[model samples]
Target: MQKLRHSSLAIAFSLLFSLAVQAAERPNIVVIMVDDLGFSDLGCFGGEINTPNIDSLASGGLRFTSFYNCARCCPTRAALLTGLYPHQVGLMRNGNSLTRNGVTIAEALGAAGYQTAMSGKWHLSRTQALPDHQKQLDWLNHQSQPDRTFSPVDSYPINRGFQRHFGPIWGVVNYFDPFSLVDGETPVDEVPDDFYMTDAITQKSVEYIREMSKSEAPFFLYVAHTAPHWPLHAKPEDIAKYKETYRDGWHKLRNDRYQRQVEMGLIDPNTYPKPELQGQGDDWGALDEATRKHMSQLMSVHAAMVDCVDQGVGQIIDTLKETGELENTLILVLADNGASPERYLQPGFDRPNETRAGKPIQYEGLFTPGSETTWGYIGSYWASAGNTPFRYWKAQSFEGGAHTPMIAHWPAGLKTKPGSTTDQPGHVIDVLPTFLELAAAEYPQTFKQNKITPVEGLSLAPILSGQQRAGHPALFFEHEGGKAMIADGWKLVQPKQNGQWELYHLAQDRTETNNLAATEPERLAQMKRQWQAWFNRVKP
Candidate 1:
């Protein structure tokens, strides 16, 4: 009897060891998404922002030049997490949950025995204000709301396959005392005096990385930052660095970024001559002295916010290095969308009117921008420069609206030429698919008894191996009536307010400067038909 028992124990030990070996062989993965960052805003991608950590990642990995987002925050996030078209995942126009029909990357990887955690924005949940205005204000100010329930419990990140979640549940937030700030399902009402939203997101991410490093199983960390977005909130020290830099005006900013892009071999200057801003003015010289100074201060605040995010990226890199997870860890850095062009006049909807100290927020009559007591925006002039070479800003289908710089870095596993950039067009939807490929996780036909939506994005693994995979046959886009279709190096775009369909041979024109709607009649009609077919199938 003793001999038989020993044999059975030996068999069990062998099986457990096999499982452990399999788990350790898998690489750790991290996805960092920043909000409202421009296509050329990062130092690695032609901007002057100090992003040494992210730039180092690019230096040791590869950059995707034609990466795209869904042209809005929530939509892009939904697509990125689920690997499905945003419309098919209950976020066609936002204010909805990431439907059960789609499985998140966390869910898939978690099922594959990988530990998962997310630290930052979780704007996939419903974000509508209550009918009671006082209650809404109370909740926004973090003064009240005895009830802990702000969003649907099922849709919260804690329940959405993240073993732990720490961040805001809503899209809009105040930097100091952010609305919808939560730790798992519990509300984080009070904060320290020096709490900055960007810094908090980074700290939590670093904390999670260290904690997860203790586990044997490889982990997945999603660090979604709400930096460089509206309200222009940033710290004073971060703002001071860029105050003098942006006073050169938007015209010079745009020209400088574009010139750097060409000189760095990021883009071919042959077909890509510096293009004019779409539906916005580029004449920064026209502003009066007061307006110019105010505008410069606003952009400085925006740059500071971006700089803070980069600092967080640096911290994350250091944490990874310290934890001995720098190698064999895949890190992807990309923006949620292009720079926002919206302006603010007052606190409306979720925007707060008073600080926690009962100070009235200032907007019309300029107060110091980036303070919790004031509201400010970079406006279209600065936004146009931010998007550089691309035509339109956020919420539009033009290149400026959807295009983003994507860096893929895996120190131990990288196979591509270091510091090289690829023109391979990729979308946020491809993110989940790439993670799945990396983790060797399977996408289920049904998750939690719900028939899951099929992934619309292709894997980018082939590109990482220094080879081209068969990319998308066509890329279709639509957000708030801004429409575009790209196929066979051809593009058809209709700006929301413009009300006209224009065609461009992207390989030739590159900037949509010369319209070919009248000349390429047959090709235009075919593309329109293709786009109409795609819309018909995917419309929400």
Candidate 2:
């Protein structure tokens, strides 16, 4: 009789143990970032391109209208991962290494018993080839053997915080023949004939999600894609879908996106009217048949790149749902930077290593890079419409460069208001704090024998809960003297070339078309002082 009583007690304890494990409340996180996507380039965000999977997230979650990036690729990634300003992380300029001081989101979450994996682009490096490095710059100029190669030290994704990472480590690489790619610590050299880089990354991400679902601990996945950024490569089939679509040129496309944006209810109809489109060198009616065809092809390639990213997003979301983890996983989707406005299609430009042994290698840009194939950038006129009603392009401190579409989706925890928009002031630096708050994790003061920089961001838990009002107060922005400052509802922006500061009440004019610099000199000066003080504390 005593034996039977002991057996009953053991059964009860085992059952309770199972229930406790299942009841754990910590949520998984997946932060997906795309490279160089335009603000109005997604269907959910007013772009005419069909991104149903992404649109689903917008329909089921909150879309942020006032989200901001660091205005460039490496800088934004550094800030997003470290929860500190990019300059503080040693990426004040391009090609700087991600220092060992701060704990990245992956490292922090990993310490808190989470599985961390990173895939796709990893551009944050502590060092790269400089002019003094073996005369590489001289070689490029003379087409001689380059003595120095572009190399990053101690800045690989896995080295920083991720347990597993796969993707290109450099800033940009050819989609078909990429450079400096790795899976974990090992370099990947071979790809199947049918291999599309975007599809491959998506597949790997899905597999990672599946494996993590079986683990007792939660997971944090950062999937960064090098799409729609450069070289404009895409599968032939995907390109075919958009071939004839953009033939009408950027003007029609911009209008179409604006109208679609209203239909999706992503933007307020009366909030801000569309800005005038700035015409470029070639008008739609002016270009010859062949030139027009080439333009259409280039635009098609760009669109396909985005479509691939959207498909990948859908795959991850579907995998999470299948494993019953979708409801609890916090998903944040954003772009790394603005659209490429460089004119890569200029005359007399050729790929560096294109011609060899009297054999012509077909290259395709308006001007080609290393080959005879002509390849060059599409100019600012098209890019203006790419960012859609926003001024300037990548590398600028203006909204066109800094502002991006941000979407958050969490079925179990985050507030779900389908088709709703939030104008809350949030920046890439705030992402780490938001995740930390959700996971109940603490930030460390130091890691790996290095003194860590304190995070300079506040948690957005209140904003997500819809309890807080107004964007972040005193938001500061700068990129080598192209500067802007926001305090209260007033914004002071300084254009390039030492242009006079312009003022605007952002709540009333988000497009920044009107310059109130002449009318509000006192307010502009006050805001300028505020920005200077903040920058002094953060800069050398």
Candidate 3:
């Protein structure tokens, strides 16, 4: 009996050792995505906002200058989650659902034994029907009532392979009192008075991380923050920090950010000349004093939202360190799309005209934004500055709308130099393949017996390891009828839906300032054919 006990103890010890080794081999992954942030919003990316936590990641890892998103919110998320274009996943437009034809990164990694969790906005599905009880709450508050039926169970994050999910099901929500708050499959009807969406999302993420650390298996956490998006909801203390920073106006702000980008080697000042400002010219002095003050306040609120997100990042980093998972963790930070240029408020069942605390919101006239009682947007003037030195804003096919800053930091994985930058052209579709490569996870040919589309992205592992590699032959993009194709530093973009194609040699004129279509007709035709082929393959 004594000999048998000794053998059993030895076997248990060996099993635990094997589990530890496996966990170390597959590093923990945390992908942090922020919404509606411009390319230059983070401090490390040449913006003035305080993003020290995110900046620290860039300082220790690599920053990609030519990374591209889908130029909108839901489409970008779909592409990033699946290793295919958004249209391939049936998300060609904002309200589309994820098709069964594609598998998500979580689904792939979870199948490989990685614990998966997501906290924050899950906008892949259409607006879900509200419960009868919640419908009564909406009616009692004099708010717009939603459809009676709920969203398909398969469309929720939990159904999409997230073992845990805590956030709103819809795309946009009031930061203070969000709609469709869900903890797993159940809806959270009441929230604490101090509950803020950004903070709550981070708190849930930290909790999930801490819990998962107890298990021997590795974990994947997606922290999607809906900060600084719209309605300009920010805490008073955060807003106070930037209330006076934009007093000099956007023209000066744009120039300052551009100069900083050059100084940091993030942009080539000579090759990429600043494009002409989109809306108003660089004449801050001409604006009336009242208009100037209002614009400044709006920007301050926007900056404040970004600041709060950074603070959450700091907390997450601290949690990792405390749990002894810091070194073996891979953290990626990026934005869904460029800065938004939307000027009007679109109130609907999703966007209620009331706060979570039962206060009516005013959408018109000159009222102080960033408060709970008001809804405000930064408009095109500041948006042009937000995407400094780039043309246009979100939803267009221009550089500003599609390009985003991407950061990757992993002490135990990446072999690249610290504080480095890569000019490799990458897209959101590449994210899943990159994560799969790191996790040693397989992208299945079929998931749950449904045939899956093959991944459309190339693994960026070579570039991350300090090796020279040829990237994708060409990247194609189309949204709301606007289309663009980039191949070998030559780009063909159409600003409007079904508009004439304009060509630009991105190597020389990345800003799309000088059109070269007429000069090179043959090259244009070839590229157009390539784009059409791609569109036919992926378009919904």
Candidate 4:
């Protein structure tokens, strides 16, 4: 009897030890980036959009109230993925490529035995947008073919370190019929009838996760969704829900979002006043009924796009839970940039949807505002509110452009008490360093075949452990000459297209209403010169 009991005890002890060993293995990393999402889009971020999945993550993880990104899409992605400023990575704007100087986060993680994959928009490329040569190229490239296509290498994703790539390489595309998408090296021309771009990206990501689960190596999945960006398209069912909600113009919507933001504690009432709409047309109230309806419909579609993204987040979370990897996965979610205020010409980019070919289409603004056929955007009126009390919109060097919603979740590692928010001002560059430290991975001095620049961000691991570091001394910013410097909580910002220098204490006024440039001229001059010096060293 004693010998039998001893054998049973030995078996139980072995099983427990095996479980412990399995738990000691590294965790998978999933970085979900939403393109052109505003600061107030998510539920946790104080928007009216119902993003329960994302909100759940915030309720159970760390929410960074002052997270920053590069002022635009390609630049933000380049900086977030490469741990360098966008210009340093050669992605200063759209059509810029990832140069050999900086190593991507994928490359670094892959070196540490990570199965790297990326799905959805990959905008890092150096293709020149030449309207004059475009017609000639289309004719020359496809002489006899009805369907015209461009070369892949002009902006392929695989060349930039991701092992698996899917979705459009360009910035915008038809949601129904996407172009420049690939499954590995082969082109994917056909998509299912039930295909929504957001859903497709998520499905492909789920498939990648499943395939990588079989490998002993951990995985790094970059799921970049091109949702909620113009031309915004959403399912009919989803769009119907937000139909009458935005019937009121942007003025009312801005006020509503501001109230919600204050209620959520995302913004302090005493710190910043409600943002006033900028660039609104003088005849905004006098607009015709047709135009008013179209504008409201456009906003509805934008909201639905966000809803679809939230659904995608749900799918990813469910996948991890099903695979028993939820407990050990570190998930980071953020927007590529703040809400874009860019406006594109409507009436379709390609041949207009008309019966006659030689009718000489006049582009009478027939297409809906945010539809794929229109190519128009939700302008600064909506954009200002999209960013809540923040000033300006995308492309501005102010908080409105760079500040974004960032949430981090790690059941195994992040020990910050659940439902906690951090006021630490962090940037996209800090992500790479933080992940490297968490994964116990080292940045390669010479990645692949070329020497790489040292990472500029410090690891935010201390914050994850419910502690704060000394914090960043000076955070730099510049895009199209719009520049700013954040030292402690004071910010010095300049608007694009030759706007004057403005200064504010961010902690006291996050919206940047009080321009301290006149009051604190000496401080503004000092910071302006400092930013210029940093730009001299780092600018591309």
lDDT tens digits, residue span 63-116, model 3: 998999999999999999997999999889987678889999889999999999
Q: How big is the positional error of residue 256 in model 2, measured in Å on the Cα after superposition?
A: 1.8
lDDT of 4 by residue, 301-399 (tens): 888889999999999999988888888888999998888887655333232332122222223464554333444467666777788768777878888
Cα TM-score per model: 0.94, 0.87, 0.92, 0.89
- Those runs of model 2 whose alpha carbons end farther than 4 Å from true positions after fitting are 1-24, 130-153, 283-286, 344-376, 469-471
Q: What is the TM-score (0 to 1) of candidate 1?
A: 0.94
Candidate 1 stretches greater than 4 Å from native: 1-24, 146-148, 278-282
Best lDDT goes to which candidate? 1
Clashing pairs for model 4 are 95-125, 96-125
RMSD, one per candidate, in order: 8.1, 9.1, 8.6, 8.6
Going through the candidates in order, what is the number of backbone clashes in each?
0, 28, 0, 2
Model 4, position 225: C-alpha lDDT score = 91
Per-residue lDDT, model 1, residue 104, is 96
Ranking by lDDT: 1, 3, 4, 2
Candidate 3 local Cα displacement, residue 88, angstroms: 0.6
lDDT (10s digit) by residue, model 2, range 216-315: 8899999999887765667767766776788888888778877877776666646556777764476777888777777766777788888988988999
Off by over 4 Å in 3: 1-24, 128-150, 280-286, 356-358
